[model samples]
Target: MNLRNIQYPFLFEVPVLKHMAGFAGLLKRDPRGWPSDRPVVGMFLCLDPLIFCCQPQPRPFGVAHHLATRFPDETFVFLVPITMSLERRVNALALAAQHRRFQKTHPRASLIILANTRDEERLLRRLGVDVRYAPQNMFVDEGMYHPIPGRERRFDAIYNAQLAPFKRHELARTLPSCAYVTKMFTTWSPQLKRQHLGKFVCSLPYNHVILNDVTADDVVPMDHVKVNRAMASAHVGLCLSGLEGAMYASIEYLLAGLPVVSTRSRGGRDVFFHPDTTLIVDDDPRAVQDGVVAMKARALPPDYVRATTLRLIAEERAHFNVFIDGLRGRQVDRTDPRWSFEYAHKLARFGSISEFEALVRAR
Candidate 1:
């Protein structure tokens, strides 16, 4: 099928499901050259509009290069670069190779890589990719994830990461009371989801709660509302990744009015971190646990955390707005609360393209 005909990249299919996802040893060969063949994130292709994709880490199997090759000349593209200063699986050499193909295949198509941190911007620039610093988490839906006043904080920390090794879940194993609102091949068969999640749950020492558990009952991975409530029930949120794209969970935690304990690493997940409510620690179990304990002990007000983080997020959004306005040759009023793109994080949250557009219409 022609990717050009496919308006929604989420629907991109591989030859088979087994070869689609690069992780969990699902693929027979290295996905370094081409990660998930399936469309794992939101992407759009059109004749008139500026083509865009909220690409996740582990680049999707030469898909971007295909877009460059197929799209009309001088098509503009924006990408949110994954922070991968150090992670064996995120082969920068392969990423560079795929992107170099993207540039060569469509030399006239201008692509702007969005970075959460200056370091990431520099990294992409070194790779000969045009980049700008704009924390993508600035677009998270605050309406979906505000503090629920009545819920008591039950878990000391909740990690909203997918079950990938690069996410570094092992670091959080020692935490006394934690929650895994994790997503592990949630689209796969129930038996497979249950088999792996059961083992993972059993391995964790003090997991007060585990979302998407078929081991306990037949619960699929939650939608946004449930994830927000689960986050509210935790005293702190955790970002354990040593490298990744803007871990959307960091901003999700702050928006849910929870203080965050994050390991210092690449990828600008910490861009919106409130200095008083957030702590960055070494990538050690003891450090992570201690940081969580300290943040929890501070007894910071939930509203304060939410408000401060929103302000920081707003600043980043405003910066991005100016840049986009320049590109469009007209201001689109992006900061207007009712603007359709206000909560574009739905790109990641919504599984289907129709669901994403419907929510956009509702707003």
Candidate 2:
């Protein structure tokens, strides 16, 4: 796991590496043939290394593209967040064309693991790259989120997300009975604080929302343990996100055996939502209020919630293995009933050219 000798020639200048070193260390120790002296470089070359390419941010994408171009002989695997629909900021057509060009020019040099489902696949295919679905990494630690049999339900509702604009924390202004648990500040730098003062001020109104006949406490950030405890004691959880990759907070609520009242998450949360477990509503105040009332009145079986969480956890792990195995030039058992045809096709399609040649020699 020692990465002291590892060289990140391109990313050495990036400030975020300091925060990511520990996670990189864990990747260095994985049995997936991670490069010992050049761990970052190894990640690109390793047989199916799981690279979490967060948010499709410009910098990360540039870095990955640079590495893939520089080391064309190596295979790069990326877990990417695919936008379901084109946003004002994102050009889905151009992005898919870029991927197609890369795949065509470099062939087996890169593989994309998409976070969203069939919609992303369809979009990418229209853009000329046939993308396949992979399970979004949304698993929670079971030990942290499991239900406590005798814990008292103290709060009527809880909102478990950061005080960010996309999360729609202002929705709490409409739900007077809900407790808002969110971070006080995004960063500590005074200069940055001054820059973000408008956004900070905009979030301040949520703190003034009346709850339980009193002005609720200023939203305070707590560690996972405290958040889990608060969720365990709450009767329901609220997720008012305008969009989501997976809505991790909603999954946490379900894992804690609390019925979730959520707006359409517009992503992977659709896989988990059911009438028996969740109340999906529009972004309106009255609809949320009615959904909250319905959620409280309905009875959700704790065992069902627990079972669903476990099932998702298993699926995430299995699909992740499939991704890894595909990257490693290992043949997945096609005869196995659990093997997905799309997964098999992607493995065979993007497999290393040398590996395919070796397979031909063996045959």
Candidate 3:
């Protein structure tokens, strides 16, 4: 596939391009590269148009609009890496409506890629849309986040996530010998001062948490090499988020052969966080502390973690191939690994008991 044909929204931006290069490298290995023999499946990594609007040269949005207008019959897929919180669900519904209107005009295949969670799948299905789930955070590029041989695991633990309230960076503050890394995004304007101040105010008491700001403006580039190097140097990955679609940092740590100490992420994380690989705990601080201790005591084989990560990636690729094949009107097995819902209950189990009870009561 010629990546050139698919205009990347922030291609001119060096920082975003660096990150995109890593993802593109993985896509290059896929059997369905751009300019493929089969029907084209245009995949947008994000659905936020504001990101492109903020760019000085917003060609990516224009290209997307052109695709919808010119090639209405082409297959398109939009990926949502983040979970659909109540507020996000509202936005997603609007986007779904827009896509539905586009489909009405051209009548080609379209799908939304989300984490393997029954709530999200059922939500979209109820809205009359085609949806698919990857067993893990499928957007993680294996080429960018793999174990580096001979690299010593210097740090006992690493917390790699945004410094938002839901991430619970304070939980990591008490962990011994842990490195904290975060990416802060904000718009560039006079209000940027207030934004930084607000972050500072919110991070009080735990003031040691240093944030690496990667705002909409080119303040700091997301250096994957540096990020991956830090991840590889850590013995364990820590994710204390109250909720998530699939904590990308946790998966990154797993792919780097570091066992994870994570809270029960309410999304696709359960697909991989088995007894052998991760220490799952409640959101309580004491539980997190104990989980960390347990993770340290556990001797998880690096090879085992690496092998499991590769298998997950392979499975994701197989699922994508099936989606693509279906777009081509080819007969495909519905019972293939791609269609299995065995892991759906994993997410359901961790979901809110009150919510479940309400649903049961409603029925």
Best by the lDDT measure:
1
lDDT of 2 by residue, 170-225 (tens): 56556546665565343334443343334544554432321212113233457667
**TM per candidate:** 0.73, 0.63, 0.63
lDDT of each: 0.64, 0.53, 0.52
Output the better candidate (1/2) by lDDT.
1
Regarding TM-score, does 1 or 2 come out ahead?
1
Best by TM-score: 1
| Model 3 deviation from native, Cα RMSD in Å | 15.2
**lDDT at position 155, candidate 1:** 85
Estimate, for each residue in 168-199, the C-alpha lDDT of model 1 and write its tens digit. Answer: 78788878888878766435455555655566
Lowest summed lDDT across 10 adjacent residues in model 3 is found at 50-59
On a 0 to 1 TM-score scale, where does candidate 1 land against the true structure? Answer: 0.73
